[model samples]
Target: MVAKIITGKTIGGVIRYNEQKVKHGQAKLLQMGGFAVKNLTVNDKIQIFKQVQKLNKRTKTNTVHISLNFSPKDKVNEFTLQRIAEDYLKGIGFENQPYLLYQHFDAAHPHIHLVTTNITWEGKRIETHNLGKIKSEKTRREIEGRYQLVKAEEQRKQKVNLLQSLEKAAYGKRETKASISNIVQEVIRTYQFASLPELNAVLEQFNVCAYRGEKESDMFKKSGLVYSILDAAGNRVGVPVKASSIYSSPTLPRLEKMFFRNKEARKQHRETLRGQIQEVLKSCSSLDEFTSRLRPKGIKPVFRINEEGRLYGVTYIDNVNRCVFNGSALGKDLSANSLSARFSLNADLPYDLEREQEVKMGWHGNEPGKRTQLVESSPNSYQTEDPTPYELKQKKKKKRKKRIQ
Candidate 1:
């Protein structure tokens, strides 16, 4: 069994999430623990949990939401699920707490949502520090052994491939949206990507991406994140949904925090990605060719290209290692500017568009194609042979102005 714990300030949202599933026929209320009445309506259950939570007035974030997920291969029953929930609560120090458990058949796997108050009947909040890493994980392994269920350690190893087994929008259910939400939630929590661009390198593999709006736009300025479904060519196919629309609420602010946290957290794997790049570079000549070779190995080479197609920066996403690194994050030698110079020298070609732009912008001695010194001819004199594209453009504009006048 895999356990997911989410603590919140209020129990209302978590209760409503499961109750809605039950109301929509996607879930069933399996059992109620620490409740006087065995038979209660959804509203009755919600009110009961709220009343218990009101016992403790001190704690702000007092809601404890727990989800226990069984492998799709497991044929778990309502009775077995109830026992699992009870043990999980006891294991995580939530025993004797007013909690409601419901089994949700929303996905291919069998999972239950347990909603309860961390604020005990004695008017004290429960300590949940490192609960997942300590109590929850130990309990999960024990449960897996007792019930002979698929081991979570093995499930975690196959998580990337197991994503394919999730149900879609079929059998009269909207699993597509749920599937996307589940995947994004998992990826954000599991992958160590330092930036949104780096995050996309992982998301793109699942045909999903999170996009912040255009740089100067109001949405981007306000730091908004929109999640979209991508097609095979990497083009977004459906409507770009707001990050807030998803259950996990992976907004830009939340992601920015994750970025900084992951920046240093992911550094340990940089050398592995660098080694992979070095191996590929040994067999490749140009940047384009190197990128093509990396694709088959599930490494995406993202380039920051200027208007003149000059590569200014690069970031590599090594999906196999589940790590992302900016070129300089690995080392200065792998930086875009450094790599560009190396590529030019190795191919025996002129320096790339960076140098080309220098000449165009008059940074070099003279413009490559434009005459620095104009011919000593009269201002009104025209070339007898032919007109250039720019001259033709000027004449057309003049003619259009005359017609307008």
Candidate 2:
């Protein structure tokens, strides 16, 4: 359920992008910013944007990528995604690019699409360093807070040690943000029951429910956002506790042992699955099968190719609580991972057969041998090989000679 909002000029072209054209543009963009850029190309133009060809497009629209990564490979909910898109102009400096042109959101991970003047509103330059990585990390942290995301792996050892030393206690998910806020804000605030059972006596006031197994997912989405104390501020005492301080109490103390115990087993399970995924690799008979093949093991496959071919990775579609390991993304991940489930994956299978398009559409050689068209900028940058600019130009001459024949 990612929603996208775009602002700027909307240009349309192939259902696909002209990577060759956008490559030249990205080279130029990086040259201007004086920062190295990687895995970039254009997205669908007018048709995909679904706007009028002429200036008919309006300003201030929405677009975003929703993400779900709840359980190992399940997304909790991405009703929408939010982002800010930026296109550099002839000149713009880092300091001046502060302002964003458009902000958008969708159910999954709402994001924004910006059509910025290459030249800043005032002529200057833009600056970006590891733009993708930085943006991804920042977004992840925010989501962790807003959605109560947890680092289940970290709790493995800590929970085990605590279990051995003392009689255990249980607590439910924090109830109200304001009450939690008051307690966390005051360092002196502390509460305790005589023992594990007593903790439940107090928890009774909060009405917390503990869940386990796949059932834990039953209440994952739509759970109210709760407040917690955060420690990043060096606020050892500033707030009593924060979301970062908490581990989701979806499992009660009695059952937590079973759900959170023995990571070695889970680790082995993941390893075995990874090996099995390698065996599952096979050229898909149809596009539908190809997309459907990604689910069972938890991979979300999006169709977008890069200069080398595709740049996507193991993704998730949480609503169904399935992994979206992209078959296309396998080679980059050492060709590991699997897909053993699903029937109907996506509506549009590979390219329409009537066109006789190659099944592996945008796969260019890793080295330069073929040329793709120029495209705009986007995050979906999977690529195949293509010809060197010099070679592509040389091939054009061959085409002319054949035409002369």
Candidate 3:
């Protein structure tokens, strides 16, 4: 089980979070300890916790909120979960504290949240320092072995090979600082990308982008990193949050070590990426067409284009394999220059019919009576039909009418 302990200055906010979950039908009051009532209601439970908290006036941040998340694969029941929770509290020196234990069904995993006060009957506070790394870690391992639960390290290994669910931004789902931190930690740990550009290739799939400050700035000189959320079209959605401010401090120095390590580690997966690119390129005629075919296969092709509309570089991030690769890493044939030349030869290869309808009509170059065709409009611009002789006469009549007016 994964244990997350959060300390709060007050108990009211902590109680409201779990109680609100129960009110919303997202969780249930599984078990309680050191309370008098046999069948306590939510209000009673809140009152009891608050009453215990009022006993100790010297301690601030006395609230200890812990969430123990068991693997979803485990078939443990409520009784087993309660026993585990009790053992964890005892192991962590919180057995005597007044706490509420809850079972949350909101996530895929089976988890329990325990909320308690650190202050005791004699107005003494419990030691919470190094609780996670020492006491909690030891208890977690003991319970995992005793209950035959899946090891956390093994689960992490399994996650490294699969794509993380990073669905498109929703209408009202607000992104928090914690959510971004979890995403950064997951991506940095799982995906194999050599540099920042390659890392962004993976992060962009999840509407996240990391930035280094302007080239001339002091932060840039210090190799600082900032993270921001991205919109559907890959634009920054809000102000970038600094990496240091995040919980794990995924700063540039840390990512630089990863960059060098990934440079060598990511090389092992290049063949797989190359095979997928080759399969798509052979079946699809143009870059536009190739991308449409690739998306369904969980492979996104990122093209780097120059100011003159020349394809300068290419990168492919395989969501299925959870790997990122620049085109040059694959081979000469898959490089941007080679693919650009290959695509230029087949500019009219069926015109990506499905894409043609979706592409917006727009003006291109400095040409009259001509406009760019939708989707794959390249090499030659399509011209509008010429005016008929009668229409020309009608145009002259209209011009004459305007002059008379």
Candidate 4:
């Protein structure tokens, strides 16, 4: 079992977060403590929590939000969960405080969230400093022994093995070919991606990318693929290893076959990703908040932006299912254009006003008025406007003027 505690200033925000889950049918109110009323609404809970918070005016960080996560292998039912919650709260000196306990079903594991205030009824604040290390740690251990639950350290080891020991491919730390080969092979064998770019999206997470050279280059014409390690800035850093040289031989032809196979294989799992995204979107008003909220749920949102910083594409990588999906493939509403429009509606400034400010500040590169269009280089890969061709044309013109002079 793993215990995580989050401290906040507003108890209402924490209450609403759990209540929203209940509304979506993803969670249930399992137990309520210290409340005189038997049945209470969301607003009722907030008002009750606020009344206690008002007791200590100086305790700004009064809300204590905790989640107790159990291993999936552990068959913990509601009765056991309630017993653990009650005992754990008492052990942490929060037995007397008013707390709402919720059992969340959104994730694969069995977990319960406890929302309460650290401020007591007597206007005294419970010291939260080192609370996790001193009190919670001791309590968690005692509970584990009492229930015969899987220890947290053992659970972590199991998770690492389940992830196949995958790690970022640092250029100098390991043998380049071997590191890239292991990562690419594991990704190809486990993940479902229909195109090179979708595959690259997953690879980039490990600081590696599959490159086919420039479009006009002979290598690209030959349909050659090379695996290269990416630096911290996403630029290719070491010697590019040919696809044919690797033992697994993940060449273009083989990958193309896998792409066709994966298109159908990953369809059934799309709804799982879509549902998680929709739930997170309900509470988040901005892109950054959306990304942060999804991380704990094992979903990574990859946004493709142009040089002007306009979002052109969005992809979701569902780590739990080992699947990659472009937003449009899931549904029209999940597409980048739709998401951008939603965010604009939630933004403080109007979209046009923000654009005007950006242009005035010269935030959109040197050519402030240049209209950047997204060019679909492939069925799945959306390439933003590349200025290299235009820049080169201007450089050639300067050279000719120098010769004329």
Best by lDDT: 4
Better of 3 and 4 by TM-score: 3
lDDT of 3 by residue, 188-241 (tens): 856777666678767766677777644334555566778877666555555567
Question: Quick one: ranking by TM-score, best first?
Answer: 1, 3, 4, 2
lDDT tens per residue, model 2, 1-405 = 121122223233221112222332311111112113333234423232332222222332222211122322223322322211221111112223222122211112222233322223333322333433454445444545555545434322221111121211112222233333223221111121112112222222222211111112222222212222222321111222333333222123322232223222233333444454444446565335655775554432433333443322222121121111223322333221212122222323232221112112111111222222222332322121232454665889899999999
Give lDDT: candidate 4, residue 216: 50
Residue 271, model 4: lDDT of 91
For residues 101-169, what per-residue lDDT tens digits would candidate 1 score against the true structure? 899876646889998878888888788878899989998888888889888877655433323543332
Candidate 2, residue 360: Cα displacement in angstroms equals 13
Give TM-scores for every candidate, taking all chains together and pairing residue i with residue i: 0.63, 0.20, 0.55, 0.48
- Count the clashes in each prediction: 0, 97, 1, 0
lDDT, candidate 2, at 141: 47
Backbone clash total, candidate 2:
97
Where does candidate 3 stray beyond 4 Å? 1-164, 167-172, 175-179, 292-297, 345-405
- Model 1 RMSD, rounded to 1 decimal: 12.4
Number of the top-ranking candidate, with TM-score as the measure:
1
Q: Where does candidate 1 stray beyond 4 Å?
A: 1-4, 19-31, 34-41, 56-61, 68-80, 102-112, 119-180, 231-239, 280-315, 327-405
Quote the positional error of residue 345 for candidate 4 in Å. Answer: 9.4
Residue 239, model 3: lDDT of: 57
Model 1 pairs in collision? none
